[model samples]
Target chain A: MHVSAILTVIGRDRPGLTQALADVVAETGGNWGDSQLARLGGHYVGSVLVELPAGGLPALEQALRCLPDDLTVTLVEVTPEPHPPEGSRFSVSLVGQDRQGILREVTSVLAEMGVNIESLETGLEHEAWTGQKLFRADVQIFVPASLPLEVVADALEHISGEIMVDINLSEALR
Target chain B: MHVSAILTVIGRDRPGLTQALADVVAETGGNWGDSQLARLGGHYVGSVLVELPAGGLPALEQALRCLPDDLTVTLVEVTPEPHPPEGSRFSVSLVGQDRQGILREVTSVLAEMGVNIESLETGLEHEAWTGQKLFRADVQIFVPASLPLEVVADALEHISGEIMVDINLSEALR
Candidate 1:
């Protein structure tokens, strides 16, 4: 049986860093699958996914521990796992002037509706031109297949209108 | 011109939460594009993205401020920013044994390769039978079009083998 893993590595930025790390993975008989690497605050940050022979972790760990002084490696085993549930999906976003007491009222409604949130990202920015403060949030929700999309949209719209915020719903992207 | 914002509200969790927030957004004539709301640590946490008509914030703020008690709202402005230059898009992932240092090493190599990691997610699970760990990372990157995919894969593979991990590279599903 094959064992799976994901590894994340970080260190001071420099040359030969990748080659050095690759050397370890290559020698371990692991296959490199995916990655993302970037420089943040003058340091390198990377994440990757890999697979190993069922009983290869001991040897793999031994090899990783031998990394050069400047490099460090941590391995994460990837258990072949079940997937997320499937359902109808929708998204809603809201933005307005900065204040208090907004999130509580909105989320309570969704929870009551039994909506499953898939992903949510939020951020704040002050407009350079207008010098105005603004707030924003994007949320993706998984609606049960049996639910009516229009009804959900209408309910959300009612909530948005009541809150003086905007509401829109759509099928999940991707 | 319309102004857009993302709002995040977090406070002790209770009933009638989201509705209070949504009422404010709706009253402000903002369009709620998406949202995410949940409970964390006895506190209700929610985020919403809203698009408002020009000059509608003042009323929106007033409406939000009047929401039923015990909930607070903080608005954040969101920018629909474009991806950065050096214009390359790719995804990468790794699966391997759970350990420290893997993220550090892999990121170091990617930075050396001039890759920009856009988003990353990692998960770890322990095997009940063996007590071994499985690690997985999913990542998206913006690479220089000049960089060859095979070379990238080879470098990642080299590192994976050295670290005794697995890696996969592609345009998506990393």
Candidate 2:
């Protein structure tokens, strides 16, 4: 039987890195699946899903370990869940001047409301004219049906005012 | 003394593609700035910002043309704008069963309202239990200060009903 696994790889960026990983997976009879790989700050970081015969995992792991250039690989077994839990998906965004604790404060409120963050992307950018630093975040969250959007909005609005930043919460498309 | 340029590259997925591009830029006296690069469907695609002395641009272009494999590179000149126009930034999102004309219809409304889409990301996913295809989009937009948020929200709400989708519009955090 085939089993699913999550493989995370990280190393200094270099040429032929992806090919090396693919070569190992192919040799081990692992079928590559969904992955998000990127070069950040001169480091290659990625998470990949793979399907392989249950018996071949150890060999795959061993082969992956043999990759050159100090690449670190971690493998974890995963079971596919066919159904997503019932919840309303929403998108939350925050943008303001650079400051510490923005994520902490916002996520704290989310945690209090029993919200789960599914995906989040954050970055720092400069304002077009002033060239002032700006912190921006986009997050996808799952809100339990028991909680109302207004409750979440009110709580966030309260924080937004204190932080002097803009906070937007809306139902996610999908 | 320096000019900014946007470079976009797309090619078959392989190792060392980023390194290759970086080498060319470095040799051309370009300082890499911000970049977003990703692998999608066996293809590598990326956009990068570079700052370089004006005279180095021609050499950079020449070096990029010599990259191994058929990677396509396009460079466009960008001037740093000091100030954003007088407008409010907003987030607009829509989610519903996969259907045709959703983008066309929604964008048409924005156009009529004199709204500009700054960035947009859209995707399709399957429903958890039913496996139905769902289409979703998240957009960051600029609405002239003269136009109120309620106006944009109302226009989208009207289309949401006709398309049987959920739509939300709110001032973006900024």
Each model's TM-score for chain A is 0.60, 0.92
Name the runs in model 2 displaced over 4 angstroms: A1-174, B80-83
Runs of candidate 1 exceeding 4 Å displacement: A1-174, B8-21, B34-47, B55-75, B79-86
Which model scores highest in lDDT?
A: 2
First chain of candidate 1, TM-score: 0.60
lDDT tens readout by residue for model 1, B31-136 = 6554445533234454466778887766777677776544556554444444445556777888789765576677677878877556565667677789788778
Compose the digit string of candidate 2's lDDT tens values, residues B1-174: 887666666554433455566667777877665555554333455456666887777888888888874676766555444355587778887788865445556766787777766555555679999999887777667788889888888889898998799998877875
lDDT of 2 by residue, A1-174 (tens): 987666666555443455566668777877655555554434455556566887888998899889984676766666444355567888888898865456556767776777766555566789999999887777667787888888988999999998899999987976
For residues A1-174, write the lDDT of model 1, one tens digit per residue: 877665555554444455456566667877554444444323344545566778887777888888775454556565434454456766777675644444545666676776655455555668678877666766677677667677677778887777776656766676
Per-prediction TM-score, chain B alone? 0.65, 0.93
Instruction: Look at candidate 1 and tell me the lDDT of residue A95.
Output: 73
